[model samples]
Target: MILADIPIPDLELEAHDGIDVPHDLVALSEPLEPGQMLLLRTLDGVHRCAEVVGLDFTENETIYRLTYGAPMAPEIAAAVARPPRSALRHWVDDIDVEVLLGELADAARRTATTSQAAAPESSW
Candidate 1:
């Protein structure tokens, strides 16, 4: 069965220059669904192909950060520098707080189980 089509906020991504690395990271304005790809463009004629390789969830927004395959434009680097301070804005109006809390509980349980399994028994 198909889930109801919900409009996703367009990914207004900004390129983050890797300080000590060769690649560049882009911050997505919206979370990319599984198996989705993107063709990104800029007004000054810059263009790139991208896909979400990783995601970081915050209290309100789930960030779909990606690495641009080629070197990012200087304009993009400037944009990246400016947004980090305010990227984590709160937008939990329609979000279910309980569901978010439940994820934390699940994470804690998973961590506890993994640590217990990894722990080695010692002789008394």
Candidate 2:
């Protein structure tokens, strides 16, 4: 899948860079489905990928629980590896849902290819 093939929503996020590690506070217009991958851009211009595990609303604010993963850009991998904390309450307003979806499709393709290569050939 590509960026043009997916439907994306407009979201507004509050910037939170109080500490050395920068993250965003995202308020989703709609509830995110489970296992949805998101592409977040940090305040310092780093692109990171995360999978949405759960969502909760508190005090009229939607909180998304994400499991942080590898950096999209190789240059910032080292920086993203070391973070000040691992809390998952922050949100970012600007994200390319299309790009995130594309990445997910690509990953799935790679996994399928690897599995096919490893499987033994059938005589049928």
| TM-scores, each model vs. reference | 0.31, 0.38
Off by over 4 Å in 2: 1-24, 74-124
lDDT tens digits, residue span 74-95, model 2: 3333333433232563543334
Q: Residue 73's C-alpha lDDT in candidate 2?
A: 51
> Lowest-lDDT window of 10 residues in candidate 1?
1-10
What Cα-based lDDT does every candidate model obtain?
0.43, 0.46
Quickly count the clashes in candidate 2.
5
Q: Please state the error at residue 82 of candidate 2 in Å.
A: 27
What tens digits encode model 1's per-residue C-alpha lDDT throughout 13-68? 24452111111233434446634555454444344445546666667655555444
Please, what's the RMSD in Å of model 2?
16.1
